[model samples]
Target: MKKSILFASALLASSMLFADSLKLEGTIAQIYDNNKTLLIDSIYGGQMAIKVLPNTEIEMDDCGIFGTDKDGTFKDLKVGNFLE
Candidate 1:
C-alpha cells in the first residue's frame, strides 16, 4: 500500500509539472531582420519567440534565443512578449 501511494504521488507531481509547461501555437507574428528568429502568438493570448533554423517550426525550452546581453541590450526580442 505504501508503494502504491508513493507511485501515485509521483505520477500526480509529474502531471502537474507537465501542465505548467508552455505549449504555443499560432502564426508567425513577427520575424527579426537577422533571419534567425520569429515571434508567435498563442491562441490563448500568450506570445513568445523561438530561434529559427532557416524555416523550421518554433519550439520551447530552446535556450539562447531570447534574453538580455551582458551590456543589458535585449537579444533577439522585442516588447510585448514573454519567454515560454
Candidate 2:
C-alpha cells in the first residue's frame, strides 16, 4: 500500500511539471530555428537553452542599431537583444 501511494504521488508530480507554464527571462544568445531551441543569457546565471513553441511570442521594444530603430523578430534578434 505504501509503495503504491508513493508511485501515485510521483506520477502526479511529473505530470504537473509537464503541464505548468514555463517562462525564461534573459538576453538572446543563439537561436536555432531548425532545432526549435533558444539560448539565453539567463539572469539566474549563465546561458541556458529553452525550447520554443509554435505559440511562443517574442516582443521587442526600444531596439536600435547605430541610431536606426529596429523591430524584433526571429530574423532581427541578435546576440545582445533581450528576451522574456
Candidate 3:
C-alpha cells in the first residue's frame, strides 16, 4: 500500500541520518561557556568543537564511589578530562 511504502521510505531516511557516526574519544581541550561549546582533542589526532546543549548528558566514569557518580554540569568538567 502507499502508506506502507511511505513509512518505509521515511524510516530509511531517518536511519541514514544516524548511520554515519564516527566515534571520537579524546580529552576536553577547552570549554567556551559563552558559546556553549567544548573543544575536544580527538584521538584521531586533532581538536574539534562540539556544541553543549543544556540537555546534553555528560558523565564521568568513576569505579570506586559505589553510588551514582554525581550529575554532571559544565562547571565540573575540567579541560584535561578524557571523553568519548
Candidate with the greatest TM-score versus the true structure = 3
**Model 3 lDDT tens row, 5-28:** 999999999988987686879999
- Tens-digit lDDT string for candidate 2 (37-62): 77999988888987867676656565
Clashes of each: 0, 0, 0
Candidate 2: segments with Cα more than 4 A from true spot: 1-23, 63-72
Question: lDDT by residue for model 1 over 1-84, one digit each (tens)?
Answer: 999999999999999989857576565677676756668886677766667564443233334657433322224445444434
Off by over 4 Å in 1: 1-22, 54-84
Worst 10 residues of 2 by lDDT: 63-72
Clashing pairs in 1: none
lDDT of 2: 0.75
Task: Give the clash total for candidate 3.
Answer: 0
TM-score of each: 0.35, 0.56, 0.68
lDDT of 2 at 74: 68
Per-candidate Cα lDDT values, in order, are 0.60, 0.75, 0.85
The runs of at least 3 residues in candidate 3 whose Cα sits more than 4 Å from the true structure, single-residue gaps closed, are 1-16, 65-68
Model 2 Cα RMSD, 1 decimal: 5.2
